[model samples]
Target: MQKTVLNEDHRRSGARMVDFGGWEMPLHYGSQIEEHHAVRRDAGMFDVSHMCVVDITGLDSAAFLRRLIANNIDRLQVAGKALYSAMLNEAGGVIDDLIVYYLDESNYRLVINAGTAAKDLRWMAGRLADWQLAATITQRREGAGALAMIAVQGPNARQKVWQALPDCRSACESLQPFFAARCGDLFIARTGYTGEDGYEITLPAEQASELWTALADTGVQPCGLGARDTLRLEAGMNLYGQDMDENISPLDAGLAWTVDLVAPRDFVGKAALVTRPQQQQFLGLLLKDRGVLRAHQKVVTSQGAGEITSGSFSPTMQQSIALARLPLAAAIGDTVEVAIRDKLLAARVVKPCFVRKGSILV
Candidate 1:
């Protein structure tokens, strides 16, 4: 298994390690709930080095990406602007949903899910070869190869990071959301999966340990995958394989906004998307009664039956929450029953369930 540059740091901090997508990563420091609250209230840093960082450069980079991703890259006009998009197969199924950074006209960067890194790269390369497009694609998959990523998130996330890395003040202080900049060796992106104001920093892997220590000194708690999962779930972010996959279209995953159908250009899955009738819908569920929600639990509604895709006890909401896939006939404010263990628990269907930063999306 691969180990990140901060592996020793995590070990020294009493992290319980686990194998995640072939990477030995910290699952939790001590308590997952404590880490989750730290991120929600103050600041917490996550070692996201397991995620794949790929650089796409060449004369045809912009044109290449326009055809490759579902979203309109033209929307990213600024140099450091970032786009959230999905790479679809010919069947209109999502291969992966990724964040693409428009570094320049001739260069772009993609942050992809860790588990699908190898397959994603090969898929892109194969498509590029078939299109007869010439673009240089490089993958930074392992230690010191090129870059490492760290996500610092929460209400006070930005303030804490600025205190630790003062040199980034000029470039990041006034940065807008979804914007990024390269400050010396640090590539700071004002983005995160958690619904918080923070940055995702990409830097040389060798420098990751020291940077983690500096952030720790600034009272930033080191978080792990366990806390990240609950936080993202409460924030209404989708997990790649659980919430979506190659067998499912983004439309059913509540990611239709990421698809661009009026670009005046056809992408790989455009025809399939156009012809398919909307069948399933993704939604949030709040357990009204007792019992924790979990993946693969059966959901019985008045309309029909559905399945919970991603479900957990929400640390923030203090209740069991879930993202479920069901028939489109399932309406909001409907009551449903989730089969947990040997009992049926009551739950309420809602839109998104929760949103951070004072947005009551539910």
Candidate 2:
């Protein structure tokens, strides 16, 4: 199994390790619930080096991305600006959800999921060939060089991160959300998956351990994938394979806002998306009774039956919540029954986000 630069550090800190996307990653340091609460109340850091970072460079970079992804790349006019989009097949199914950073006119960076990295690269290469564009894709994982990524998140996340790298304070302190900036070799982005104020920093692998130590010295709690999952679920963020996959379209995956259908520009999935009627609607559920929600549980509604794509006990809300895709008739405020084991539990339909920046929304 592949291991990140911080694998040894995780072991030294007594983290419970698990296999995730072919990488031996930390599931939790000790208590997953405590880690989740730490991120919600204060600062927490996560080792995310398993994610793939690809650099796209060439004269036609912008043109190539415009036709490759569902979101309009033309919106990324400023340097260091980032756009969240889905790379789709011709049938409008989501291949992967990614964040593309516009570094310059001829250069852009994409962060893709670890499990889908190989397939995404292959798909991108074929698209480059089919379009006959001059753009080039370089996977950063190749060669002797290694890259380490870390996400420090929550209310105090940015403060602790700045304390660790004081020299980068000015460069990244004023960065707006969804934007990135470079301080020497360190690429700092004011972005995160936990729906909290934080930075996702990418630097040379050799420097990762030292940085992780420095951040820990600043009292930033080390979090694991388990807490990260609960945090993202509470934030209403979608997981790639669980919420949507090659068989699901962005329109039905609570990602319609990310898809640009009004623009006249044609993209890879434009034809299919325009022709296909949206069959399912993705929404959130709040269980009224006591029980843990889990994926694949049957959801019964007055309209029809649906299945939970992602579900968990929300640490911040202290309740079981989930993201479910049901028929269009399942509207907000509607009551539904979830089949948990032999019991059918009642739940209320609500908007996807349960919390944001530590505040309860629903």
Candidate 3:
């Protein structure tokens, strides 16, 4: 099994480890609920070094990415600005969801999910060859394993992160959301998965342990994957394999806003997306009756049957919340029946996002 730079630190802190995407990662550090609350109420840090960071450079980088992903890369005009996009196949199926950072006219950086890193890299290479693009792709940690990534999230997240990296305060203090900046060897991005204001920092692997200790000294709770899952679910963020995959299109994955269909620019999946009918609708569900919701549970609606893509007990709301893929006719106020075990439980359809920046939306 693979391990990140902070694996030993997690073990020392008594974290329960589990295999995730072939990497042994911390599932929780006693009380997953408390960790979830920590991120919602205060500050919490997560070791996210398992994620892949790839740098693309060359004169054709910008043009290459514009044709590669569904979102319009032309929107990223400012350096350090980031754009969230889905790399789709020719059939309009999502290959992976990623965040691309605009570094310069000829350079860009992409952060892809750990599980899909290899496949995504291979697909990117094939596309480059097919298009005859002159972009060069470099996987950051392919050889020396020199990179480490960490995410600090929640209300007090930025404050504690600044305290931990005092020297970087000036460089990133004015950094806006969905933007990034480099301070010394640290690359700090004001982005997160939990719908909270925070930073995702990438630095040298050798300095990761020291940085982790410094952040802990600032009273930032160390969190694990279990809390991360619940937090993202509450925030209505989609998990790559669960909410979407090679078989699902962005239009049906609660990611239609990220797809640029109006722009005249042609992308990889444009033809198929324009031709394919959007039969499925992705929406949020709030269980009206008792019992927790889970993925793959059958959802019955007046229009048609659907399935929950992701579900969990929302720590902030203290209720079961889920993202379900239903028929196009499923409205916001419509009632649905979820088959949980032997019983059919009633649930109400709502917007996917339940919380944002610690504020309960629904």
Candidate 4:
């Protein structure tokens, strides 16, 4: 397995290493539940260097991105603004979900999933070649220009990050959500997957350890992938491969809101989406019976059968909750049966989001 820059540090801190997308990353330092609670109640950090960061530039950069992403890039009129979008295939299948930071008309930054980084790069290259665009793609994952990313999240995340890096406070203190600011060599974005207020800091690879140490010294707990998964699940965020993939349409994956179909602008999969109507309604399910919901579990609804896309024991809710792709006829208030083991368990349909900013929505 490939090791990130913090692999040694994670080992030193007694992190239980696990293979995630070919990279040996920490599953947890000690108690996974405790780490999950720490993020919900206090400040916690994660090493996200395994994810890929690509910089797009050149004269046709804006045009290339407008045609590339499902979300309209024209909304990013101001610098430092970021947009959450899905890059879809010609068939409207979701290629990947990413956060694009708009720096200027000629430059933008994309943070993509680690598991699909290689494939995403190849796909983007192919599209560029076909379009003959003048945009240049530069990946900041390795070599001299390598960058290490750290996500500081939770309610007190910003304050702790400010305490650790005092110089960045003034610039990023007023930074709104879904925005980014470049402070010296640091590219700080006010974006997080854990449904909380925080910043995703990207800095030179060599300076990563020092920064992590500083943040840890400031009482920021180091979290791992185990906590990361539960947090994102509770926040109603999608996992690239589990929740949706190349064969899954964004419309069916609860990501239709991210697609800009209203705009006149054309995109890769706009035609397909226009021709085909919504097939399923993506929603949340809360287990009423004492059982845990898992992915691929069959959901028996009034209209027809569906399946759980992402399910787990929500730390904040203390119940088994899931995100499922159900039939359009399934209403939010309806009760459904899920096949757990040998018996069918009861689950209530609700909004996909169960938790946000420490508030229990469900």
Task: Report the candidate with higher TM-score, 1 versus 2.
Answer: 2
lDDT of 4: 0.94
lDDT of each: 0.90, 0.94, 0.94, 0.94
- Name the runs in model 1 displaced over 4 angstroms: 143-145, 358-361
> In model 4, how many backbone clashes occur?
0
lDDT of 2 by residue, 21-138 (tens): 8999999999999999888899999999999999999999999999999999999989999999999999999999999999998999999999999999999999999999999998
Question: What's the C-alpha lDDT at position 173 in model 1?
Answer: 82
Clashing residue pairs, candidate 3?
none
Worst 10 residues of 4 by lDDT: 2-11
Q: Is candidate 1 or candidate 4 better by lDDT?
A: 4
Report lDDT (Cα) of residue 114, candidate 1. Answer: 92
Give the alpha carbon lDDT tens digit for every residue of 145-209 in model 4: 99999999999999999999999999899999999998999999999989888999999999999
Weakest 10 consecutive residues, lDDT, candidate 3?
138-147
Per-residue lDDT, model 2, residue 65, is: 95
User: lDDT tens string, model 3, 235-330?
Assistant: 999999999999999999989989999999999999999999576999999999999999999999999899999998888898999999999999
Write candidate 1's Cα lDDT for 250-319 as tens digits. Answer: 8888889999998798888888889994678899999999889998999998889999999999887888
